[model samples]
Target: MGTITQFHLAFPVRDLDEARHFYGEVIGCPQGRSDTSYQDFDFFGHHLVAHISGEGRPLQSGRFDGEAVPIPHFGMNLDRASWEALATRLKAAMVAFHEEPHLRLKGKPGQHVTMFLFDPSGNALEFKSFDDPEQTFIP
Candidate 1:
């Protein structure tokens, strides 16, 4: 409704070069400021920083709408075109999907197209889109 604010998230990674390649090359995020220990990216307009923290932690899972989704995932709500294009790009890059691209909640108020995947560091990410953007927050 008003000016949407951008988000900033910093997470750990096993290696920096791996992260740079994945975020910059695979995900198509523009690289930002960085040093040896940390780097930043324009993650779908959000400020996402990957910090060097070896291996990080084991991922957990939770059931959502009959699907077992990664417990601690982060991602964006994109437009349909962008969501589909990214899905295609990830597939072409051979990124293993946590949840393959598909429609969810069909005919429901919250129907959406979504896909899930992990970065090289094993941090899970989800990207979704809705025909009606307001469906993103509907009850």
Candidate 2:
């Protein structure tokens, strides 16, 4: 009923080993019990799974607020200060963004700042923050 407490997401990846390296090694997500067909990751604080889909596949993305944004993606909401700090941290870490940190609904209601990133498994994760947290559920 608040900022999402936790979530579970599964994405397709061509190689389990590569996915393991990326999620578990590069991004520094904690590893979880898994099998050959799939692997689980303790993402920040959520449960994320990567399954062996196939090879040579690319996820289609679109544009949002002057930046290329990923479709069919999922992410979490953070408090304004946390979101700002995360955007700063991602930039400092040289993390590539499908959409740079900026308010999405420019010239409209619920104009919240957000950013998007891709995992090695080709899943999109958006981190969003709102100036007025109460506006979060406004119509």
Candidate 3:
């Protein structure tokens, strides 16, 4: 792959300290510059900023592979090993999963392992790994 560009996302969180602990300690993202109102993290090479706000968007659900998934979630697609490692880490930390880690789309073009969870501020995040990386965009 050529020079992949990093994406930036700024989202709301209820508290800075809670965001710090979750993104830094639980998720293992190296923190960047931060202040009383916002915190930045290196989310798998992408830039993620957690800004303090009263509350975030309301929760909604959508269906995927016969499962209910939170709408408007964000996350990264990792290789198999990294995905498994993160899953193990989250399990050990006892983070409540919005959707348990499991393989979906079996025998299909985009077969993959996936999991979902919410941050302390209720922002949904998903982590997944395609069985065949090349099939990431397959319809």
Decoy 1 TM-score against native: 0.58
Give the total clashing residue pairs for model 3: 0
Cα lDDT tens digits, model 1, 22-123, are 998999988865666666687776756676765666425544456766655677767777777888889999989988999987897757888888898987
lDDT of 3 by residue, 1-139 (tens): 2222344455667777999899989999888656555666877777566766645543255445677666556777677777888898999999999889999989977688989899999988988777876555333
Worst 10 residues of 3 by lDDT: 1-10
Clashing pairs in 2: none
List candidate 2 segments past 4 Å from native. Answer: 1-68
Q: Write the per-residue lDDT of candidate 2 for residues 66-134, one digit (tens) a residue.
A: 554454467766777777778888999999887788788676554678887888887788887656654
For all candidates in order, the CA lDDT equals 0.71, 0.68, 0.72
Scored by lDDT, model 2 comes in at 0.68
Error of 1 at 95 (Å): 0.9
RMSD of 3: 12.1
Q: Which regions of candidate 3 are displaced past 4 Å? A: 1-59
